[model samples]
Target: MDDRGGAPAPPEKISAVPVRHPGRWVAAAVLLVLAAMLVHSLLTNPNWKWAVVGQYLFAPRVLHGMLLTIELTALAMAIGIVGGVIVAVMRLSPNPIVSGIAWLYAWFFRGTPVLVQVIFWSFIAALYPYLSLGIPFGTEFVYFDSNKLVPIFVGVVLGFGLNEVAYMSEIVRAGILSVDRGQTEAAEALGMTRTKIMRRIILPQAMRVIIPPTGNETISMLKTTSLAAVVAVGELFTTVQLIYGSNYQQIPLLVVASLWYLVLTSVLSVFQYYIERHYARGTVPLRARGFRFGRAQGGLS
Candidate 1:
C-alpha cells in the first residue's frame, strides 16, 4: 500500500469504434461521376485539336520560352527569400520605426495589383529618366538611363521579385511567430547575441513552418510567370500565345502550354515533398511512400 493513497479507481470504459461515414462514399461517387463527365467532354471535343497540341509541344521556340520562365521563377524566388528574411526581421524589431517601415513596404506592395506593378516598372523611365547613385545633395557618382537599365526582362523580374518579397515577408513573419518565445529567452540566458540567436536557434525551428507555404508560393510563382507576356518577355505562356496568334489554333496551343506547366509543377511538388521530409526529423514523418502498383500480400499469415 502507498503512504497517502491506495490504488486509483479503474478508468472509465469507452468504445473504440470509429464513427461510420457512409456519406463519404456517396460524395466520392458523385465526384467520380463529375470527373468522368469532364474526361468524356475533353475526349469528345473536336476543337481541342490534340494533333496541334502534340505538334508544337516540342518546338524550339516553346522550349526556349520554358527555359526563360524557369529562369524568371528562380531569380524572383531568390530575391523574395533573401529580402523576406531581412524584412521579417525588421517586422519583429522592438523599435516602432523599423517595424513601421517594414509594414509600409509590405502594405503598399501587397495592396497593389502585381500587373500594375509590372506595367509601372516597364515604364519607370517616365517617372525617373535616369537612376543615379550618389551622396544625397552632394556628388553624383554614377548615372544610368532607366529605359536601358530596366528592359522588359529586367522589369518583369523586378516586378515578380518585389511582389514576392511582400508576400514572402508575411510567410516568414508567421513562421517566426510560430516558434516558441521561450527559445529566445533561453538563448539570451546563454549570452547569445541576437544575430547568433536568430541564425542558430530561431530560423532553423521556423523553417518547418516556413517551408510548406514557400513550396506553395513557388508553384504559384511558376504560374504567375504567365503574366510576363504582358511585358513582351518570352516566357512559356507568351510562346504559346505567339504560336496561337500566328496559326489561329488558340485552344490547342494553350493546351500544350497547360500540359508543360503541369509537368513542371508535378516535378516541383515531388521536390517539395522530399524537402519537407528532410526537415521533418523528430516530428511524425510524412507519408513519403507514393502509390505502388502490382503487388499485394494476399494469404493470411
Candidate 2:
C-alpha cells in the first residue's frame, strides 16, 4: 500500500473483462456467405441486360433529362426551404389568426395528393383561362392564359415546392422547438428583437437539428421530381420513358434511371454524413464509437 494519508489503494488494474458474443461471429460469417452468393447470382444472371444498362447509363438524352431533374430539384428545394421557414415562423406567431392561417395552409397541402395538384396546375387554363395582373377589381394591366402563365415546368415546381413547404415547415418547426425555451427567454430578457434572436441565437443552434432532415428531404425531392413526368415535364425518368417507349425496352431503361438515382442518393448520403458530423462536434459521435480500427489484443480463441 502507498504510504499517503488515505486508505490503501486498490490493486493495479489487471485487465478488461472478456467481452464475449459468439453469436455475433456466427452471424457475421453467415451474412458474408449470403452476400457472396447474392453477388455471384447477380453477376451470373443473363436476363439483367447489364450491357444495355451500361449503354444508356450516360446516354445523351438521359443526360439532358438528368440535368432537367437536377434543375427542378434545386429549384423546388430552394423555394420550398425558404417558404417552409416562413410558414414555420408564422405557425409560431403569437397571433391566433396568423397561426391559424399557417395551420390551414399546411393541412391543405399535406392532405392533398401531389399528383392531383400537378395535373390541376397543368390544366389550370380550363379552370381560369386568364390570370390578370393589377388591382384585383379595379385595373387589369396585363392578362395571360393560366396554362401559359403556369406552364408545365412551373406547374410541376408549384406542385412539388408547395407540397414540400408543408412537410419542410414541420421539420423546421420541430427543429426550432427542440431548442430549449430558456434560450428564447434569455434572448428576450436581453432586450433582443425577435427577429434578431431567431436569426443569431436560436436558428444557428436549431440548424444542428434541422440539417439532417433537410438533407433527407433534398434527396427525397430528387426522387419526387420524377412525378413531374405526369405533367409532361422531360425529367430523367420521363426521358427514360420516352426512350423505352421508342425501343420497347422498359425494364432495361428503368434500370438505367435506377442506377443514376442510386448513385446520386449515395453521394448525397455521404455529404449528409459529413454535415451531421460538422454539427455534432461537441457531442460524442456514434460513428467513432461504433468500431475500433486499430489492431486488437490477443483473443480467447
Candidate 3:
C-alpha cells in the first residue's frame, strides 16, 4: 500500500449468518398433533376388532387375489407402455395422416370414461356375435365367437391398456419435448440420421423426465385394476366382494383388500424412491453428513 501510494484498508470482519427455518417448527407441531390424535383414537375406541384384522390379514384366498392383482397390473402396464411409445412416435411423425390417426386414437380413448370402455368391451358380443379378422374385400382370415374372444379378463386388459396408452402417449411426448432443441440440432450437425439421433441421443436423455411419470402411471394402473371388479374379473376387490357376499363379513373382507392395496402401493413407492434416487445422481449436489436446526447448528439443549 505504501509503495503504491494508496491508503491501507482496515482488517475485514467475518460474521456467521443465522439460517432461518421456521418450517421445521411447524412440522414438529404437526407431528405432535397427529400423535395426540392417534393416541386419543386408540384409547377411546372400543369396537376396533384386532382379532378379526389379524385373522383376515394373511388369508390364503386374499393372497391369491393380491397375486392376481399384481399379474394384471404388470400385464396391463407392459401393453400400455409399448402401445404408448408407438402412439407417441406416430403423433410426432412428419406425415399428417400418421399424426392425425395417432391424434384421433388418443382423443377417443382419453375422452371416454374407462368404466364405460370396460362395460362396452364386456358386452361386445351384443354388437357382433362373432369376431372376425380379414383383409378388406377378402375372405375372413380368422373367426371366433365374440363370447370367447372378449372374456372378462380380456375386457379389463383392453379397457385399462387402451386408456392408459392415451395418457402415457402424452407423458412420452412431454418427455421427448423436454429435451432441448439444441441437442437435436447438434446431433444433426454431427451427421447423425433422425433415427440415430432419437435412438442414441434423444431417448437416453429424455429418460430422466420419462421415468418418474411412468412409475406414477404404473402405480396408478395397479390401483385402477380394481375397476375390473365391475366386469367380474375376480381380481382383489372382486374376490373380497365374493367372500363378503357369501359370508357377510363385509368390513373384514374389505379391510383385507384395502390392506393389500396399501402393501402394493407401499412397495411401489419404495421402488419409485430408489429409481428417483438413481436418476437424481449427478443432477443434484450432495451435502455434508450433519444436522442443522433452525437458526443454529444444533437443536435446543
Against the true structure, whose TM-score is highest?
1
Q: Write down the worst ten-residue block by lDDT for model 1.
A: 285-294
**How much lDDT does candidate 2 score?**
0.89
Can you write out model 2's per-residue Cα lDDT over 179-270, one digit (the tens) per residue?
Answer: 99999999999999999999988888888889999999999999988988887799999999999999888888999999889988898899
Candidate achieving the largest lDDT: 1
- Candidate 3 residue 63 C-alpha distance from true site, Å: 0.7
- lDDT (CA) per prediction: 0.91, 0.89, 0.85
- Name the candidate, 1 or 3, with the larger lDDT value: 1
Each candidate: RMSD: 7.6, 6.4, 6.5
Per-model TM-score versus the true fold: 0.85, 0.84, 0.82
Between 1 and 3, whose TM-score is larger?
Answer: 1
Clashes of each: 0, 0, 0
What is the Cα root-mean-square deviation between model 2 and the actual structure?
Answer: 6.4
lDDT order of candidates, best first? 1, 2, 3
The TM-score that candidate 3 achieves is 0.82
Residue 75 CA error for candidate 2 (Å)? 0.8
Please report, as a residue range, the 10-residue window in candidate 3 with the lowest summed lDDT.
Answer: 285-294
By TM-score, rank the candidates, best first. 1, 2, 3
Residue runs of model 3 more than 4 Å from their true location after superposition: 1-31, 39-46, 189-191, 286-301
